[model samples]
Target: MKDILEIRIHGRGGQGAKTASQFIVEAALDQGKYIKAFPEYGPERRGAPVAAFARISDKPIHTYAPITNPDIVLVIDNTLIGFVDVTKGLTNKGILIVNTCEESSKMKEKTKFKGNVYTVDATNISIKLLGKNLPNISMLGALVKIANNISLESLKNKIKEKFLKKIGEEKTEKTIESLIKGYDEVR
Candidate 1:
């Protein structure tokens, strides 16, 4: 990974993309890295297109805007590919993780993604494990596995700390379980 890691997350308004960025910011903070996580959007309603960004480094962060050339891009909504250029800002060595089963060759051919592209059925896993269609936790699991900057345990701890009270014990447990399942499934 670079000394400064930039991550961009894409999803619909209710899919937890912003939450994923916030969780990652917390996890990176736990790892002692300077980080900034924030969302960019025109509207703040569910089902609208939403994006969140996270920048992590050993030094201080000073900007909060849409990441235009991120090292990593996480796509929580596969359908958004048609409407949004999710891969537009990806760096040459950047990697893309999409919530789809599409083959790498296909994605590259379709999106012209010059860098590595990885896919996972995040929505399926989320629905199966959480009984809902939210992709944040699952995509976060996949992100952790691919990035390898933060341990799964660290993310688990953040989840507990971040969502325990908001979602309650049962939902939080299921969310963590879904994250683990996504981590395992991606590899």
Candidate 2:
């Protein structure tokens, strides 16, 4: 990693934004990196807007609070954009990944974000691949590709190790395969 990277994730309550942040922390830790992942509690209800954060670095992390001025902002729910300023406090060199089917140019025009803005149909991809509206795994795939910290293979292995015990080896393998395919499709 070049420098300590701070990431914030925004999504509706049940969209797996919190889980995605935790997974990213686990994946980075698997690569021998230091990380902190936590969620900012909001109204405890489904469909409510929620936020989570992850900080990854080669050095020790001192901050455990919610991330403002994030270097990377992952928007897991397009609907949340209307309720939250996803780009607020973002660094000028920040990167924004949106889980929308919209074209990159269109999203850029809509948000007027003066940073790298990338879009992926993570919802559709997840539904098609996993038969569930699970966008977190696919969005993580896009994030790993765009962030370019660790190789996708390393992330995949970590994902397998984390998920296999819970989802079973066969489902884990299939999910990994879908993640790879989703990454390739977006990249």
Candidate 3:
């Protein structure tokens, strides 16, 4: 890995892409790394395409521009494949993680992506655990598996601190379950 790791997340407005970016930044910060996280949206409404970027490094990150070539790409919505060039500037050795029920090999074939690939049935996991289709929190688990820069324990703590009070106990527990499932099941 380089001194800096850049990640791009793709999803729709209601899928929690922005929140996932913030959680990643918080987890990286807990590891004493400097981080930046921000989101971009074509339309600031539910179901509109949204992209979030995060950069983590040992040193301070000076760049504020969008990441053109990311070290990792997280696709929260696989349907965006045909609508967006999700793999536009991924590095040759970049890691690609997708939230889908499809097999990783099938996803790679469908996207015509030729790098390291991982897939998790995050949507199904979320639906089973949270009674919804939100996969962002679960996707964080897969991110931790791929990045390894942040500890799952730290990430879970952050999640508790951020979501426990806001969403209450049961929902938060389900979200954590989704996260752990994502970590265990990604391939």
Candidate 4:
């Protein structure tokens, strides 16, 4: 991972973008990595666009400003591509991950981004495993694939620890399965 791997996640309200950011930070913390997460509410209403920022590093972090040039960007909802500048500050060497069924090539044309664009059907993965459309957790699986700072086991264990009681064993297991599917199926 880079010394500082900054990430921005875009999604609609209630889509779990904030939760995803928290997950990333918590998992990184478990590995003793310096991290930060910030959630910016869009319209103060559900269904409105929202974004969350996360920073992971090997050393102590000091920056408190918003991430303008993210090393990676995750779009939990593909529909926000046109409405939000998902690739606003992403560079040619940076990575862009989106929860869409579209191919990377097509996404490149749609977003006009030349960097590495990865697509995962997190919506379907979540619905199939969790019986819902919450793709935020699944997006973490995709992030795990690209982020070397945190191991997959660490993320899964963290999720299980955090969600087991609130969501029960069955649903928590399903969520983990959805996350694994997102990890394995990202392209």
RMSD per prediction, one decimal? 1.6, 1.7, 1.0, 1.1
> Candidate 1: which pairs clash?
none
Clashes of each: 0, 1, 0, 0
lDDT by residue (69-147, candidate 2, tens digit) is: 7888989888777558999997668899998888988778877888889888988887886788888888888888888
Whole-model lDDT values for every prediction: 0.86, 0.83, 0.91, 0.90
Model 1, residue 116: distance off in Å is 0.6
lDDT of 1 by residue, 1-187 (tens): 5677899999999888888999998998998989988889577999888899999888887766557789999999888887899987787699998887677677777778888888778888888878788878888899999988878998999999888889899999999998997788773
Better of 3 and 4 by lDDT: 3
Clashing pairs in 2: 69-89
Shift in Å, residue 155, candidate 3: 0.8
Top-scoring candidate (lDDT): 3
lDDT of 4: 0.90
- Candidate 2 vs candidate 3, TM-score winner: 3
Residue ranges of candidate 4 with Cα displaced over 4 Å = none
lDDT at position 43, candidate 1 = 75
